[model samples]
Target: MQNALKELILQMADDALVLGHRNSEWTGIGPMLEEDLAFSSMAQDKIGHALALYTILHEHMGEPDPDKLGFMRKEEEYRCCQFVELPIGEYDFTLARHFLYDHAELIRYEMLVNCPFEPLAQMARKVRGELKYHVLHADTFLRELARGTEESKARMQAAIRYAWPYALGMFEITDADAQLAAAGAYAGEKERRSRWLSTVSSIINDAGLQVPEPDEAKAIYGGRKGYHSEYLKPLLDEMTEVVRLDPTAEW
Candidate 1:
């Protein structure tokens, strides 16, 4: 159970850290100034979430500092899902990632809200507060894009198509999954993924957008086992370059 708890915390910490790095790409390039500020706020939230998760990891797992865990890890050693490491190619693509991740995250954290592990349960409560606004931001875009110009709609659909597989992969299970479930870490992953798809699909359909092709549309894999797309390395390099340079330096 202790190992299970550590792995579970690592899962959250890695995902939040990588996603924050990817989201930060929008710092100066978000579609509009308001969105720029808004997405950057989201990025900050992700980083902050990672920080909180890391604090727990250190205290409970006897792990190294969070910076060492986050910055020094090899790509293949990081436990983050593929969805976060994906390239934020265009506005729609970035938003699609946000939409998919925000929805997945809502369910994920909601599950954690009742985790048998106290630290995770407490962290989930904190993360859920921030993610409430995140869901609104992403869902607002989802609605607008679904009803906007044909081009916006089409692009959003394409982004949805591209990310749906990785999005499913976000809920991919691991060895700890069973123990987590047995210990009520967050319900079983299979059940949780089912709920996730239904919630996300319902929102898309309600927005008048086409239902995303099902997770079975493709392999719907990776990131659970440390495998990531080609886009991951460069992103991590940039994100950790400073930290990498001065491993012994204090912030």
Candidate 2:
């Protein structure tokens, strides 16, 4: 039970941390001034979410401190999905990724609101509030851009298609999933993925965008198993550079 819970928490925390950093990259250079602040704000929220999850691991699961767990781990030790690690590409791609990823996150947290695990359930209830706005931001941008000029619609569609497979990978099942679900600690990834599809499909269709068929879209996998793209190592290096420079330094 402990191992299963740890696996689940670690994955969630890593996803938030990596994507938070990616989102932070857009802090000053968003396509527009409003979007610039919006991404920056969301980035802060994600990192805060990561820190909270890491704290749970430290307090309950015998893991290292949140800072060590976040920055001192070897690249392969991190469990974030590859989709989050992908470079924040063009605005369309970033927006598409955000739309797909946050929908899954929102649903996942909603499912966990009543988890048997008290610490996680408490955290989920709080985090979901923030996620509501993240999803709203993504939804609004997606709908408006998809309904905009021909080029905007085309770009949004292409970005969605490109991100589909990787997004599916976010729900890659693991041995720990069955244990967690049976224990009533989580609803499992399959269920969350189902809910996510139903929720996002309607929005995508409403935006005049084609929802990628799950059966036809091959889910990109491996990050959950600690196998990552070349992108992850460099990202890890840059993120941990400060910590490495002076391990004893206090934040």
Question: Largest TM-score belongs to which candidate?
Answer: 2
Q: What TM-score would each prediction reach against the true structure?
A: 0.95, 0.98
> How much lDDT does each candidate structure score?
0.83, 0.94
Per-residue lDDT tens digits of candidate 2, residues 1-251?
Answer: 88998999999999999999999999889999999999999999999999999999999889999999999999899999999999998999999999999999999999999998999999999999999999999999999999999999999999999999999999988889999998989989999999999999999999999998896349998888898878899999999878798899896
Model 1 has a clash total of 0
Clashing pairs in 2: none
lDDT at position 159, candidate 2? 97
Query: Over all chains combined, what TM-score does candidate 2 have?
Result: 0.98
| Cα error, candidate 2, residue 6 (Å) | 0.5
- Using lDDT as the measure, the top candidate is 2
Clashing pairs in 1: none
